[model samples]
Target: MEILRVKEILNEKGWRNKDLADKIGTSENSVSAIVTGKKFPKPETLVKIADVLDIDIRELFNPSKSVDLQEIFTKDENGNLKSVGFIKK
Candidate 1:
């Protein structure tokens, strides 16, 4: 993940690490680690960061390749195909 991109966004928004940490309910050190690529945040934390930045979660973890809907459904551990969302053509 290009965590520096997040830092750049914060800088552009005139926000400090502490400000972001407070907004995301995390510590400044944790935010620093994330920004420096020393750690990865949990999904919930990623969502929180995206919400605070007014960006989509996909912007943070941009998938490099197209997802195969059929593969995803076929790999379902529970074999519950109905649980899968719409398959992209």
Candidate 2:
């Protein structure tokens, strides 16, 4: 999720961060965090976000990519997985 995308969506809907915060019962800072990906909202928050944006949750998390199992379960020397390859059986 890109901040630019969210900004575009908001602009298209003629909504401001403060307006969305009021509608969702959250603070402008929280909304900003979500838009910037500094924080991921919970399920309920996501619901509110979707409602405010008039978009489906599925749209928020578009699933068009192929599954990559290795990305789901692998780690490097630093204990941080590169998460790039498909699953190796």
Return the TM-score for each candidate structure.
0.63, 0.60
lDDT of 1 by residue, 1-89 (tens): 46436677788789998999999998999999988788888889988998999987777754667776643344456765644455666
Instruction: Give the per-residue Cα lDDT of candidate 2 at 22.
Output: 95
Question: On a 0 to 1 TM-score scale, where does candidate 2 land against the true structure?
Answer: 0.60
The TM-score between candidate 1 and the true structure equals 0.63
Candidate 1 vs. truth: CA RMSD? 9.4
What lDDT is obtained when candidate 2 is compared to the true structure? 0.75
RMSD of 2: 12.9
Question: Which candidate gets the maximum lDDT versus the true structure?
Answer: 1
- Candidate 2 lDDT over 62-88, as tens digits, reads 446656454454778899866655664
How many backbone clashes can be found in candidate 2?
0
Highest TM-score model number: 1
Q: Tell me the lDDT of candidate 1.
A: 0.79
